[model samples]
Target: MTPELLLLSADRVGVLVFALSGGIAAVRNDMDLFGVIVLAFLPAVGGGTLRDLILDAPVFWLEDTVSLWLALLGGLLAFFFTRFLEDFKPLRWADAVGLALFAVTGAAKAWGMGHGFIIIAIMGVMTASAGGLIRDVVANRDPLLLKEDIYATAALAGAAVYAGLVYAGLDERIAFGLGMLAAFILRALAIVFKLSLPRARP
Candidate 1:
C-alpha cells in the first residue's frame, strides 16, 4: 500500500480503538448513550483534528464520515455491552493496543507531511492521548495528565522509537510496526506490572 493509505488505515484503527476505550470509560463513569458517544468521538477524533488544524491539512473527520459512524458504533456497543465486558481481564491490554496504534499512526502521518522529528513526536503523543484527557475531564475525573498514569509516557516512548527508526532510514512499514509494538508492549507492562512515572513536587 502507498504510505498515505497505510497511514490512513493505521490512524483509523487507532481512532476506533480509542473510541471504544472512551466509551468503556464513559460506562464506568455512569454516562448515558449521548455522553458515551460524545466521549468516544472526542477521543477518536480530537487528536487528529488538532494535528490537522495545526498542519493546515483538511480536518480528517470532516472529509470522511466513516470515522464518525464508527465512533458512534463503538460507543453504543460499549453502552449496551458493558456488562459483558465488566468481568473481562483484558481491558487494560485493549487500551494499550489503542494507545500504541495511535502513537505510531500520528508519528507516521507527521513524518509523511514533512514535519521535523520533534514535531512528529509531539504529534504522536497528542494523537494517541488527547482524546482520553478530554474524556476524563468531561467525566469529572482527574485527568490522567494530572496523575501518574502510564498514558502520555507510553505515547512518547513509542513516538521516540518511530522517530529514531525514520531517522535511521528503516523501511516505513517495519518502522511503524516496531514503533506500535513498542508502545503497546510498554503500555501493557505498565498496566500488568503497575508501572508508572514518579510524581513531581509542586
Candidate 2:
C-alpha cells in the first residue's frame, strides 16, 4: 500500500477498536446512549489528540471527519448489540488491537516527521495508551494502562519493532503489520493466560 493509505488504514482501525473498547466499558457501567457515545469518542481519539498536541501537528479527527463517524458507528454497534459483543468479552481484546495499531501508526508518524527512535517509541506508547487512560478515568475504574498487565510493554514492543524494522531497511508496510501483530499477540496472550512482563505476581 501507499504510505498515505497505510497510515490511514492503521489509524482508522485503531480508532474503531478503541471506540469499541470504550463503548463496551460504558455498557458495563450501565451508561445511557449519550454516555456510550461520549465514552466511545474518548479512547477513539484521545491518544491521537494528545500526540498531535505534543508534536504540534494538526489533530487528526479535526483533519478528517471519517474518524468521528467511525467512532459513532462503533458506539452504535455496541449499543445495539451489547449482548453479541459481550459474548466475546471484547473490551480487553478491543483494547489490545487498538493499542497495537495505534502504537505502530504513532511510531510511523513520528518517524515520518524526522524523530529519533526513542521519541518514536515514546510517542507510540502515548498514542496507544492515552485514550485508554481517559476511558478508565471517565468510567471511574482502575486504569488498566497503569496496571501490571503488560499493556504499555506490548505497545513499546510494537513501536520498537516498527522502528527497528524501518531502520533495518524493511518495507514500511511489512514493518507496520509485523509490529502490530507482535503487540496484539503479546497482549492477547497476557489476556488469556494472565501474563505480564517482569512476571505476574503469583
Candidate 3:
C-alpha cells in the first residue's frame, strides 16, 4: 500500500480504540448516557483534530464521517457491555493501544508533511495524549500527561522510533509495527509493574 493509504487505514483503527477507551472511562465513572457519549466523542477526535489543525490538513472526522460513527458505536458498546469488561483493565489497555496507534499516525503525518524530527515527535505525543488529557480533565481524573505515569514518554519514544526508521529508509509497515510495539510494550510494562518516572520533590 502507499504510505498515505497505510496511514489512513491505521488512523481509523486508532480512532476506534481511543473512542472505546473514552467510553469505558465514562462508564467506569458512572456517567449518564449523554455524558458517556460526550466522553467517547471528545477523546476520539481531540488529539487528531488538533494535529490536523496544526498541520493545516483537513480535520479527519470532518472529512470522514465514519470516524464520528465509530465514536458513537464505541460509546454504545461501552454502555451495554461494561459488565463484561469489568474484570479486565479496559481503560488502561485500550488507552495503551490508542496511544501506540496515534503516536505512529501522528508522527507519520508530520513526517509526510516534511517536518523535522523534533516536530514530528512532538506532534506524535500531542496526538497520542490530547484526547486522553481531555477525557481525564472532564472526568475529574488525573491527567496522565501530568503524572509520572510514563504515558507521554512512551508516545514520545514511539514517535521517535517511527520517525527514525522512516529517515533510515526502512519499509513503512516495519517502521509502524516497531514504533507501535515500542509504545504499547512500554505502557504495558508501566501498567503491569507500576513503573513510573521520577517525581519532583517538594
Candidate 4:
C-alpha cells in the first residue's frame, strides 16, 4: 500500500483499539449501552479532534466516517461480549497498542502538514494521551497523564525519536516503525514492572 494508505490503516486500527479500551472501562463501571458507546466514541476521536483544532485543521472523524463507525462497532461488540474478555484485561492491552499507534501516526500527520519538530512532538503526545485523559475524567478516574507511570512520557519520547529520525534523513516508514516500537516497549515495560517516575513530596 501507499504510505498515506498505510498510515490511514494504522490510524483506523488505533481508533478501534482505543474504542475497545474505552468500552471496557465503561462496562467495568456498569455503564449502559449508550453510555458505553459514548465513552468508546469519545476516546476513539478525542485526541485527534483536539489535535486538529490546535493545528487549525479539520477534525479527522468529520473528514472520514469510518472512525465513527468503527468506534461504535467496537463499543457494541464489547458490551455484548464483556464476559469473554473478563480474564484478558482488554483495557490495558488495547490502550498500549492505541497509544503506540497514535503516537507515530500523530507525528507523521504533523510532519506531513509541514509542522516543526517541537509541534510534531507535542501533537504526538496529545494524540496519544488526550483520549485517555478524557476517558478517565468522564469515568471519574485519575487521568493517566497525572499518574507517575511512563504513559505520556513514552509518547513524548517516541514522537521526539520519530521526528529526529526523520530530520536525520531516515526513511519515513522506518522512522514510523521505530517510533511505535519505542512507545510500545516503554509502555509494556511500565506495565510489566509497575514502573513509575519519582513522585513529588509536597
lDDT agreement with native, every candidate: 0.82, 0.87, 0.86, 0.86
- lDDT per residue (tens digit) for residues 1-202 in model 2: 9867865776677788788888988999999999999899988988889999988899988978999999999888888887787777755676687789888888999999999999999999988888889999999999867876788888999999999999999998899899999989988988899886574568
The most accurate candidate by TM-score is 4
If both were scored by lDDT, which would come out higher, candidate 1 or candidate 2?
2
Lowest summed lDDT across 10 adjacent residues in model 2 is found at 86-95
Sort every candidate by TM-score, greatest first: 4, 1, 3, 2
Report the lDDT tens digits of candidate 3 across residue range 85-161.
55656656766877898988899899989999999998999898888899989999877668867888899989999
Q: Model 4, poorest ten-residue lDDT window? A: 85-94
List TM-scores for all candidates, in order: 0.87, 0.85, 0.85, 0.88
Candidate 2 accuracy as lDDT: 0.87
List ranges where model 3 is wrong by over 4 Å.
1-13, 89-94
Shift of residue 60 alpha carbon in model 3, Å:
0.9
Estimate candidate 3's alpha-carbon lDDT, on a 0 to 1 scale.
0.86
Candidate 4, which segments miss by more than 4 Å at Cα?
1-9, 89-91
Clashing pairs in model 2, backbone N/Cα/C closer than 3 A:
none
Q: Which ranking of candidates, highest lDDT first?
A: 2, 4, 3, 1
